[model samples]
Target chain A: MSVDTASAATTRAIVTDAAGSSSRARRGGQRHPATSFAGIALRTPYWVLTAGLALIFLYPLIWTAISSVSPLAGTNQVDGWGFGNYATLANYQAGI
Target chain B: MTATLHPPASSPAPPEARGARRPARRRRGRRTHGALAGWLYAAPTALFVLLLFVLPLLLVLQMSGSDWPLLSGNQGPNFPENYQVAVSNRFFMDSVIFTLKYTVLTTVILLALSLGLAMLVQESSRWKGLLRTSILIPSALGLASASLLFYVIYSPIAGPFADLMASWGFTFLGTPDGALWSTIFLIVWRYAGFYMLLMLVGLQGIPDDVYEAARIDGASRWQTFRDVTLPLLRPTLALTTVLCVTGSLLAFEQFYILTKGGPDNSTITIVQLIYSVAFQGPNDLGVAGALSVIVLLALVVINIAQIRAFGKKAED
Candidate 1:
């Protein structure tokens, strides 16, 4: 049991040393923090523009879902909310 | 030790032959089991299609024969009377002509635009990703939603283009011609990118070696494209054309939202007429069902014709 414990301790030490060296190597090879920050700043405008365009494309469906439930569906007024509009679908002569 | 523990390689009855025979029997059993498993896996999809598509189609056929009303229960079978009434309606015939016209125009424009865009974007370039994404963005919007947005855009009172158009002494949706053109424009803008994506997939399936061989043979760009690309793209083109025609024939939302069959019902689609017949007015569900059956028959005929045409080219 003592021999077994001793060997297990040696194995644990070897693994820790290997992990520490690899981490040090990675840190050494990585770009400077300031350069990485500048890279992100440079890419920001493209992301912002694309995101804005995507929102514009999606706004119509979002608007329709909201308008369907809004109480002022036929009227210009945009106040109050209920399932009143949906009830009209049931009132139609055909079974939708 | 060897004589006691092991068997001799040379025996009167060969072990190798016996071993091969055993494995062959096992393989035959495995093949039979594999076929059964395959059928078991396919059974669910077959059942689903039967229940949903075939059953509903049979029901619709039965409904078309009977005097089915919207609110009341089904009456006794009226046979061909409902079909005769549907066929005799002048408005229904006019809607059919209008739907055919729209289908032709939309399919032609969509094919041309999508093919053009696909060619432009086929090459690997810097802006290809952005161009593809930006173009496809409009297709993500539902047809109804896009029509509503265009409704606002075409409104004379509150439209952003109202002032510009007024300055030019023009109206976007004032007349039947104007409304039809506007709706067509909206549809083209919405679907061109989707069709372009389909065409792009077809284009990418082509190997680079084919183009290289064409170049080595000293064929001009236009000649090479005409001879090779068009022939190869036939299958994809057939698929897109069928989809475009079917969807255009069933068009309802754009006209309903943008024009509301306006300027004297000139923009009324066949589907809109069916909707009015079944849901509005006297609510004759029987006639509506007959009309739907007629439309389904037309679609099946068109699709079969398209498939045959494409198949002939493939054989060639």
Candidate 2:
């Protein structure tokens, strides 16, 4: 375990060494951010775009959650909000 | 992938010591136990590959030649007959064409989109963690589970979007195009973050001095990405490309759960056809094994071509 940790740490040190801290040194040296993706200012548009992408990724699972409980017309749905799908899945193949 | 991330093991001297003269060759020789330790560490993975992959591969080869059935023992050898059957199977051509189309589309879209996402998340901004986390969380879901989840979500009668889809006069999986795009969307949503993480690693592995020089030279962001980032990321691209192509070719769980090769069997991938042949109507393991061997061979060829293409690009 110690050998594994030592090797992993050594590799990380090598990575950090190879990558260098020039960007951090530059950032500390001056305040001259511009339009590069890595060097860009953390403006409102950046946050908005990233958040929007996050929503697109997360919305489907959220919708699945909502529809999982909310009643529907043709599924093995109960009369009201319930775990009908979960129940059906639990009973499938002896619920595995 | 692992090789690119680490300093090449063959380089005995550290980068800084390469130009120094301090008996580096003899005095700085490797410890004797290092090789033994490396082998000891690698033993488990080697054992696993030998057991799981090599053993199954040999079995599949044998099964491909013999008249093996799913439920019973194998009969006598049939040699080339199973290969003929596999090639002439009813859905063989259609499934191959569909799988190829899916592979191309998925590879292009996923690679481009993941590159963009990686670029976005690689920024030293506050939202980086949130975006990366959310995007990658879906990858944690098992592919089968994600397929089932999308299956319910794509259900025409019970889905959340059913009403909107009804109003729009279109269903998610009612047609070939719709089914393809919808499944692609699910796949993109699930895998984009994972691939982005990979690309991000590659991006971060690039030395900051190189980008600093680019910026100092007044190189445009686009120019820097094209000349610096793209070239440096070739190995990662090759790895991801081979992986995406292989996974997309062997795609069965998603279609099996979401579409069930349905709405006219337009989405029946090659692996699904293999499964149906072995377990479904035909119940022929020999043919299935032959198909598997063919797919394996194709994968080896495709991966070699991709890696060689990337290698030539690197040399140039």
Candidate 1, backbone clash total = 0
- Quality class of the docking in candidate 1, CAPRI style: incorrect
What's the lDDT for all of these models? 0.80, 0.85
Q: What is the C-alpha RMSD of each candidate to the true structure, in Å?
A: 16.0, 15.4
**Chain A only TM-scores, each candidate in turn:** 0.48, 0.49
Fraction of true contacts retained by every candidate, in order, equals 0.09, 0.40
- DockQ of each candidate's interface versus the true one? 0.05, 0.18
Candidate 2 residues B1-316, lDDT tens each?
3555556756687756776745555544655457778999999999999999999999999989999888886997999999999999888999999999999999999999999999877766446777788899899999889888888788777677879888988999999999999999989988998889889899889987688677656689899999999999998999899889989999999999888897798999999999998999778899999999999999899989988999999899
lDDT of 2 at B288: 93
Model 1 per-residue lDDT tens digits across residues B66-179: 999999969989999889988887788889998899899999998988898787656554455666666687898899888988887676765556698888878887888898
TM for candidate 1 is 0.70
Query: How much is the lDDT of residue B193 in candidate 1?
Result: 83
Please report how far candidate 2 places residue B107 from its true position, in Å: 0.8
Per-residue lDDT value at B110 in model 2: 100
For residue A77, give model 2's deviation from the true position in Å: 8.8
